[model samples]
Target: MHNVHVITHPLVQHKLTLMRRKDASTNSFRRLLGELSTLMAYEVTRDMPLQDIEIETPLETMTAKVIDGKKLVLVSILRAGNGFLDGMLNVVPGARVGHIGLYRDPQTLQPVEYYFKMPSGMHERDVIVVDPMLATGNSAAAAVQRIRDMRPRSLKFVCLLAAPEGIATMQQAHPEVPIYTAAIDRELDAHGYILPGLGDAGDRIFGTK
Candidate 1:
């Protein structure tokens, strides 16, 4: 609870509810996710550092505050993580984008990374990792660990929904990095899906299933 932030804004809650419905179409789910991601991104970057810069209005010059262009980096955890990327990009169009491809080993239920690519000068940027569902948290933890190896200036994890198990897993692995989620579901099912979750995010978003 200390480092986990649950966004309770009315708009965010409303959109998340629509996403959780059992009958929502793929198009509806994808559209809702895109809109919800934009709202989540607003909360994720609310505390980003800003510097005062000289600017001119129509009539007079004044000091204007702006976030550091190079201060932010978005790392999508492949597949489902890509769902949050485009919407978040709308919020921070200039932010650099990165991707980390990982899949859960069905037998071991552990994350196996097959690809990793990040922006240059990661050490100077604040990395925000995106993944839709944090069911077991293994993939999120592994992805964060890989990014940590890069020694970025800061780190944060954002997800649409998370389970208690997932949250604890991430906390134990990286307590310093806060988690932002729209909701914390009841629990994870035997198959590692979050109970009452919106189902497989990548599948729903991409109509894969």
Candidate 2:
């Protein structure tokens, strides 16, 4: 609850409903995810700092405003994170891409990192970490902890669906980082999945199930 940004746009909500249906095909789910993430990305970066500089217009010279630096670093948290990454990239095509692979231990539900790679100059760029669902918040928390170690200029967390339990966990562990999510569901189920959620986002996106 520290800094949760729940998108309430009609388009975002409508697409999310389609994704929640149990019968949504993998292709449809993936496509809708892309569209929804784009809308969420717009809200996430809406307050981006802008700077004015001299510019040449067709008629005459003038000052124009552009995002400060306009360089962003996007980190994907393994499989499900990839779903949001693509859409965000459409918003900032010049952003640098990073990937972190973390798997959860079934019993403890703790995250174990298997891979980590990022662009250089993380310290100079604003970073946004994407994960489709914030379930128990284990992997998302661990991923944020790792990224914080890099000491980026700023950091934001984005996810498609979030559970209250997951949001509480993130607020406890990384209260400094704000969260941008499409919806905050009621609770986390026994297996750490968000109730009334779109099910396994990775599986639905990749047609693994």
Candidate 3:
């Protein structure tokens, strides 16, 4: 919805299409995901603040605008979230990284956090929580709440695919945090998986399935 940003970039959609095919090899799928994340990073970081600083070029001195790389943090919701790290890091090599590990209880489909770690000075660092799928939204919501506890300068959620149910759940839980996704799929399946999703993102990325 209003809080969600669906990236329609041609390269993003093209790679996403390739990834959705059932026959795509694990290697191909993983590679495409990395490439897609790199492209998506552009949109997600579009509004990052920049400051002007003086720099000397070979021929002249000039004022250049640049972001505070040290003040940007990428928080990955473990496993599948890890898949997003490499690509995003490729673009923001100086950005700090954090992790939040959560697993869904099969029966309840609720998130249970088993690990959480973040860089110091969260209150002054902008954070982007990366997870490949926003399916049930429980894990993401829980992770965001934990980050909120630290009072980060700003917070956002990023995923390759999102289900409408998940988006609604997040909106209800934390309307202040915006969500960025390549696609908002139709809905979640009976088992809480996003329909038309590229299967379990962790499995696909790690060749676990």
Candidate 4:
């Protein structure tokens, strides 16, 4: 889809490959996730609007560019999404951070929202929803719908990896929001895991398993 962007930067690819290894240590996995998130953040924010203003550099006055409109609202889809939040905040330190906690039922496979809290005046801000893996897309899509109900001026999705099924599901449900991901792997396994994905992102990121 035109709105979906797959970051192909060499550094991102290199780090992603390292993260896929079964023997990768927890420390290494966390480090790579941070590094990869930094790269992915760059691509995700490439189209942010800019405004020109006159500025005095010590030597002379010059027109400078700064981000336009309201500061961004970084919404992390809890647990796994936190892994990407650190790097994104590194790039946008002044951004407001929010959290949405949701889980998919094992049998029904439907998303159930347990928590959601956003900054005041979120409707006036640009929202970026972050998660590490987009598998069934149910969670991401549901999360977006929840955020959309808040009426942000703009919305976007960012993840480290994605499955084709997930991407399609997201497009079908929320095509207006673009998805920025590091890689689009083969397909989803029977259990809904992305093929070649770095296992459960939450486990890999937090060293729980």
Candidate 5:
């Protein structure tokens, strides 16, 4: 569990409860997701390196802390991840954005990558893979593997919610990378959905269903 950080912020918990209600509207769902992602981003970037630099202020020259080295690359895992991208970008406005498109095959329970395009200088940047729910974890695991192939300087997974099974699966597959989430649910349902989870994130955020 060293790599996993479960955020217990009141705002995150409150919005998550709102998101769980069956009657939550698409607009509300989308707005809550943005707010939650912004909070999660704070925890996600807590350990980001910082360096001190001398700067001239209105009064006099003083040392100031700034983000160190490589700028971050926010990699959204397709449609659902896009919801989180906006909020995270609001916090780290200068972070580069990337996309990885994947869909689960209903028959095989496998993730199929349809499209993936990342910033060219991945090796020089820290990457944060965003997805809303880490249920069965097949999609997030696959996405991480694909991103790893690019040899980024560092990589991490960020999600709004996760299931224990999915966390286990992810740890087994990529233990080196840390995972950050607002909550870790009890388990996955028979159909591989997180129990008591806020329905399909993409559908909820986009009103697709």
Candidate 6:
């Protein structure tokens, strides 16, 4: 847990519990994820640098703090990661967006990237990569390495859930990048799914199954 931060707010826990229910409707699950991501966004961006600027208020002129420079970027790790975009965007409306598409090979349980796209000047911008689950860590680590190549000012990984195996994989691969998650579940099953998790996030969010 050296570089990991878990959000334990009561509301976050409550919403997560609702999302885990087996009978939760796709619409309800997606809505809960959106709400939960909005809440989690507050914590992930807590350390954003701020600068003081003088502004005239209706009552008086005073210096106020605002985030420095351009807003941060939210990089979605393909299909499931997109589920976190709206909620995070709700809180940081000015944030730029990027996408990386990777699918787990059923036989090998490894990530194979099919697409990668990002904004310009990544070296000048902070980045937060979003994914619903970090079950295997291969995709997350791969995505992080690709982003690091762009040399962003700073970087963080945000996920709805994580597993101990996946966490260890990330720790070994990219120990410097901090990870933010709502929960770290028990462990991953043989097929690389979080135990007691909400099931396939992409399937749940998109009704693909």
Largest TM-score belongs to which candidate?
3
Clashes of each: 0, 0, 0, 0, 0, 0
- Alpha-carbon runs more than 4 Å astray in model 1: none
lDDT of 1 by residue, 54-144 (tens): 9989999999999985679999998899999989999999999999999998877899999999999899999999999999999999999
Q: List CA RMSD, all candidates.
A: 0.8, 1.1, 0.7, 1.4, 1.3, 1.0
Stretches of candidate 2 above 4 Å error?
A: 68-70
lDDT (CA) per prediction: 0.94, 0.92, 0.94, 0.90, 0.91, 0.94
Give residue 179's lDDT in candidate 4 (0 to 100).
Answer: 91
Arranged by TM-score with the best first, the candidates are: 3, 1, 6, 2, 5, 4
Candidate 6 local Cα displacement, residue 36, angstroms: 0.2
- Give the least accurate 10-residue stretch of model 5, judged by summed lDDT: 66-75
Better by lDDT, candidate 6 or 4: 6
TM-score (all chains, Cα) for each model? 0.98, 0.97, 0.98, 0.95, 0.96, 0.98
Which residue pairs of candidate 3 clash? none
After TM-score superposition, the amount by which residue 13's alpha carbon in candidate 4 deviates from its true location, in angstroms, is 0.7
- Residue-level lDDT of model 6, residues 29-145, one tens digit each, is 999999999999999999998889999999999999998435599999999999999999988888999999999999999899999999999999999999999998999999999
* Pairs with steric clashes in candidate 6: none
Model 5, 1-209: lDDT tens digits are 86898999999999999999999999999999999999889889988888899999999999999984337999999989999998998888888999999998887778999999988888888999999999988999999999999999889999999999999989999999999998998888777889888889999999999
Angstrom error at residue 132, model 3: 0.5
Error of model 2, residue 152, in angstroms: 0.6
Candidate 3 lDDT tens digits, 76-184? 9998998899899888899999999999999999999999989999999999999999998998999999999999999999999999999988999999899999999
